[model samples]
Every structure is written in structure tokens, then in C-alpha cells.
Target chain A: MTDTEPRKESVSCPMDFILRMLMGPWTTYILYNLKTHGPQRFGELKRRVAGISAKMLTERLRTLEGAGLLRRDYEATIPPKVTYSLTKRGHELDGVLGSLAEVGARWEAEDAAARSQRAAESKSAELRAAE
Target chain B: MTDTEPRKESVSCPMDFILRMLMGPWTTYILYNLKTHGPQRFGELKRRVAGISAKMLTERLRTLEGAGLLRRDYEATIPPKVTYSLTKRGHELDGVLGSLAEVGARWEAEDAAARSQRAAESKSAELRAAE
Candidate 1:
């Protein structure tokens, strides 16, 4: 639907809905990890997404599952193994993720350049003051 | 830099940086509005981005400005008008935003279809119970 459409009965704006789906702290990271590394167990995901607490990881996983982005598979085994993989819908985000990564890389480069410029300016200022 | 690069002095990951820039409430909305409607005054933006508090709007604007995504113009007028517009970098996000909107539209359609199916199922269950 276009942005101008009347939404008197809609639950939420499409933009808002997608943003909500993606706004969770570790949501994108978790999705990225799953997409890149394929299906992984809970513990493996936890390790791959560094600095994420177990509580946060579990919550984000449930959110992603609820949103139909990923599937949880239960394997009958001696230890009861569980794996997570992106569903078809989840894999649909590949394009967006790739774009985001490219943008992120450009931003990183710009930031690095800015930082170096500022450092050089400061160094020159100090040298001029000493002279 | 590639993901495999070992950075001994990096400030943050590129993914983390872009995510941080986009994660703030009303950020993407404001950007989308500006991109679609062209430059807008502060008050106009505040109104267009519904539900955003003045304080929050100000914070997001500053963040966007700091990140070089948008530019703020101060026009010396009777009341000192300030306008915000997307910078070249901000405009670079058009492709990403377009993709997001498309994905969001698809998600909304899927959600609506699911709701209808559930409603139909519940109605059938009710009819069966009545019989």
C-alpha cells in the first residue's frame, strides 16, 4: 500500500511494522549470523553474537520467530538438539542486509577520514603553539 | 574493510555504526519524510513525524546532522526559521529506503492475509459449535 492510503483500520503503518521487526537490539545481528552461518543452535548463536546477554538473545529469537522470519527446528536426539534457520521470508532480507552492509562500510570509511582530519588539525595546532 | 579485518584501534563495527544511526525512534521516519517531501522546516518535520516529542525530534535531528546524513539550515527571519534537508549522504539511502518500503508492504499484506485466515477459521469453529 502507498503511504497516503487511509489506514483507519490498520494495526500499524508498514514502515512502523518493519521498523519494529528490526529495532530489537540484536535482531539484525542474529539474523545476519543465521543467514551467513546457516542454522545454528541457541548456544552457538549466543557466542556468534558477542556481547548479547542470554536473556536478550532468547527474547530476540522469540520475536524473530513470531514475526515469521525464522524457523525453530527441534531434533530428537540424546541431548535434544534445537536449531534455528531463516525461513523463506527471512531470506528475503538478503537484499536489504547487503545494502545496509555497503552503506555501513561507506560510513565507516567517512568516519575514519573525519577522525584522521581532526587529529591532524589538532596536531598542527599544538605544533604552531610550540613554535 | 572486510569483516575479517583485524582492527586494533577501530572505534566500532560498521554494522554496529549504521544500526546505531538508524535505531533511534523517528529517525527513519524523519528521513523518509524529508526524502519524499523535500526540505522541511523544524515545525513541519515535527508535525509530519507524528507522535514525536519536540525534545526527541531535536535529539534525532542532531544525531542525523552529526552523522552527515542531513543538513540543517538556519534562515535569519522574523522568528529565525530552521530547515532540515537530506545531504548527499542522506540521499544515498534512497535505494535502501525504497527496498524497505517494498518489504514492509509485502509484510503488511502477509499479515492481513493471516488475520483473515484466522478470522475465517474462528468463524467456522463458531458455526460448528452452534450446530
Candidate 2:
């Protein structure tokens, strides 16, 4: 059966669906790869998405595809051939994923400072508690 | 003591910190109001940020402030005047949020269709199992 049927959320918050879809494990990264590469095979995707396990990649791909943010096509010929690409709707999310990538880069650059600050605060709070 | 002591994360993944920060419960909406309204008081903030309680707002505010995304100032006057504003670092996150908002709009528009698709797929899978 075709998976592009339509999926919606009945979460408490109206925006929960979007948040859940984007913030789920490994979603942002998957979308980022699709946005950058246009379309990719399963092996290519697994390699491109660093730190993702094959099982995890497959799960996330299924999740995103179910959400209509991705399209997965299966080829009857060859060794389990499958290709993943973004739908028109999915491509529309490119700008959003681009912004997320930019945010990720900025945070990576500043992670050190943020860490040191957190450490100092934790230490100070502990000292206060001891006193 | 100053709350904006520069809190950071030491998550296993580099991008995890930003994702954790932005994908937190109320971060996007809090930042959204700050972006739209410039600076606002505690009550104003609580009211403007829908579905957020006083305690959650306080916690989220503290978290964002610690992350250097917000500045919270308290006045020693009779009425306990407090105001929150985005710092340069925080305001810099606006473009990222603008894109998120755009993505959110898209999802909200198509949520019904997505939901129907998911339901159909689930029902079909169940039928195949029954057969």
C-alpha cells in the first residue's frame, strides 16, 4: 500500500505534530541530508548521516516518509533497490532545515563557552549549598 | 548574582545542544514573542506565550537566559518590576526562528492530510495482518 496516505496528530498542543516530527531522534539530520543532496540511496544516506545506525536510519526514513516530508521509491529490479527524495512539500522545508543547520553550526562554535559557563555555575551552586 | 553566566551543554553530539535548546517545550514560542514584541514584562510574557504556566515560563526564561539567548532584569522597586529581552546572541536567533515559523505554518496547513494518510496506512497494515 502507498504510504503517502496522510498523517495527522491528535496531540494536546496543535503544534505538537510539527515539533514532534522535527525534534524526533535523528530527524533534523535526515532532512538536512535530503535538502543538501536532493535524492539519495539508502547506503548513501546512511553514510551521509554520520553517527546514525542502519536500523535507526531506516526507522527515521520511515517516520519522515510517513509524515509526508519524504518520498521513498522502491525499484522491483536489483538488490532491494530503494531511493529517497523529498516531495514538493518536503523540498519546501529546505529553507527551514537550512536555518536549523545554521543554528547547529553556531551552537557548535559556541559550545565550549557555554560548557565552561555551565560548569562554573554548577560549581558555584555546589559551593553555596556546602556553605 | 547575574543569571546569564553562560550556560552550555556537553552532550555527546555537537548539534545536540542547539537542538536541545530550540526543541525544548516553549523555547520557540518564547523567542517568537521576544522577536515580535522587542521587550516585555513577566505577565506580558506569560500571557503572550500561549499554554505556558507561570512556573514553566519562569523555568524556560531562566534556561534561555542562562544560554545567553535572553536577558532578564529585575527592578528593586515596590512592584517587583522584571523585564525580559533578547540579547545580541538571542536576537541573532531570530532568522532561525522565522524559518521555523514558516515551516510550522506549512505543517499546520497540511496536518489533516498527513493524518489521514497515516491512518489509512495503519488500517491497511492491520488488514494485511488479519488476512
Candidate 3:
């Protein structure tokens, strides 16, 4: 088969498409902000997303809009105010995002526990060396 | 705050961590295969994932293993067989994956419909021009 064949198959596979969409850097962060804080302006997103550059934020918003996950509304006001909000398809991701949040919380807890365990083991080894 | 501060905050956010992990290429493909087909050997995965390089697959597996999302088992058989399977935490992603699949399917259907609609519009425009 041609190289395009596998990519075509990926489009047909729902999991693959979703995974690819989320694979983009800042995609989920933007989505999370919209979900948690509701519609936000460009500057507001840039500030709340934490550490994302304006250029990257703009690119991510465009990508999200293209994917039909979010919408950009430009108000006909002075300076043309723009706000970003989730589309119905984006809101449909709530279940998935919620599940990810649950798993993420577990990962954090496990990571902390592992770190403490390692520290304890190292401390004990030091004690043994002294003894 | 320092640049590192936001990075530190990202570690605490479960959604961010999960998104980062899933962001890696071949991660979801490998996970999808394992989830659908049960445990898989290295060779099996390489063949089944479709278009992934051996090096990339190995790297993705290592990343998944490090994240506690999958377990790599070494079987002491002739030629030394290694199998990979999802861990409890990895399996915990079922809900998220399921939701993603649902959305993905909807996306594909919408995309196909849009393509056909465009095609029909083009055809009518051509007819009008000919008239």
C-alpha cells in the first residue's frame, strides 16, 4: 500500500485521530482553560496557560479552531476584541479530560510516594555506612 | 516567578502530565494495540503498529514503562522473549480512550459529510457556469 493508506486508516480510527489532535503541544492546556474558566480573551489565555508564548498560543488556538474543538469570536468593538470558547465538540471532551485528570492525580501521588521511598532508602544506606 | 516555577506547577496538574505523556508519537498506537489485542511481544508490536520505526517503538515503550503506564515482562524462553502489557494505571485510561473514540467517530462522519457537500457545491457551480 502507499504511504497515504496508513494515514487514511488513522483518520478512520477514532482513537488515532483523537490522540493525534491531543498530541499537539498546548492543545489540552487551551482546552483545559476553556473548560475550567469559560470563554477567555487572547491575553487572558496567554496569562492563565502559564509559560506559553503568545505565538504558540495563537498557533494552538488556530489548530483547535480548525479541529472544530473551539471557536474564536471577534467582537466588533474598538480594537476588535476576540474571545475563545469551546464548541460542542470540544465540550464533548469533558469525560475524557475528567478521566485524564483522575489518572494524573494518581500519577502525582505515586510519584511523590516513590520520591519519599527513594529518599528514605538513601538515608538508611547512609546510616548503615556510618555504622 | 522563575521559568522553572510554571514547569513545577505543570507537574502538579494531572491533565498536563497525561497530555504530555500522550503527546509522544506512537504512544497511543502502542497502547491501542495492547489494549485491543492483549499483551504483545516486541516483534508483534512492530508489525502491528504500522509505519513506526523499531527505534521509535522501543523509545515509546520505555517512556510508557517509566510512566508506570505499562509493564515489560521478560520471558526466559529460547531467544529471550519480551512482552508488554498495560499496567493498572494504563488500563485506567479506558474511560478516556472510550470517550475519545466516540468523538473521533463523530469527527470522521462530519468530515466525510463536509467533503461530499463541498463536492456537490462544486458540481452545481460548474453546471451553472456551463449554462
Count clashing residue pairs per candidate. Answer: 0, 9, 0
Leading candidate by DockQ: 3
DockQ class, candidate 2:
incorrect
TM-score of chain A of 1: 0.82
- Tens digits of per-residue lDDT, candidate 3, A1-131, equal 45544553741256777777777777777888898899999999898988889999998899889888999999999988999999998998888788878878877888899999999999999999999
How much DockQ does model 2 earn? 0.19
lDDT tens string, model 2, B1-131?
Answer: 15832332211234445666777777777787787788999999887776678999999999999888899999989989999999998877677666666667667767768889999999999999999
Of models 2 and 3, which has the larger lDDT? 3
Q: Write the per-residue lDDT of candidate 2 for residues A1-131, one digit (tens) a residue.
A: 15852332221234444666777767767776777677999999888777679999998899889878889999988688899999987887666566666776776667778889999999999999999
Q: Superposing all C-alpha atoms, what RMSD in Å does each candidate have to the true structure? A: 5.8, 9.9, 3.7
Better of 1 and 3 by TM-score: 3
Worst 10 residues of 3 chain B by lDDT: B4-13
TM-score of chain A of each: 0.82, 0.67, 0.84
Worst 10 residues of 1 chain A by lDDT: A4-13
> Between candidates 1 and 2, which one is better according to DockQ?
1
lDDT of 3 at A122: 97
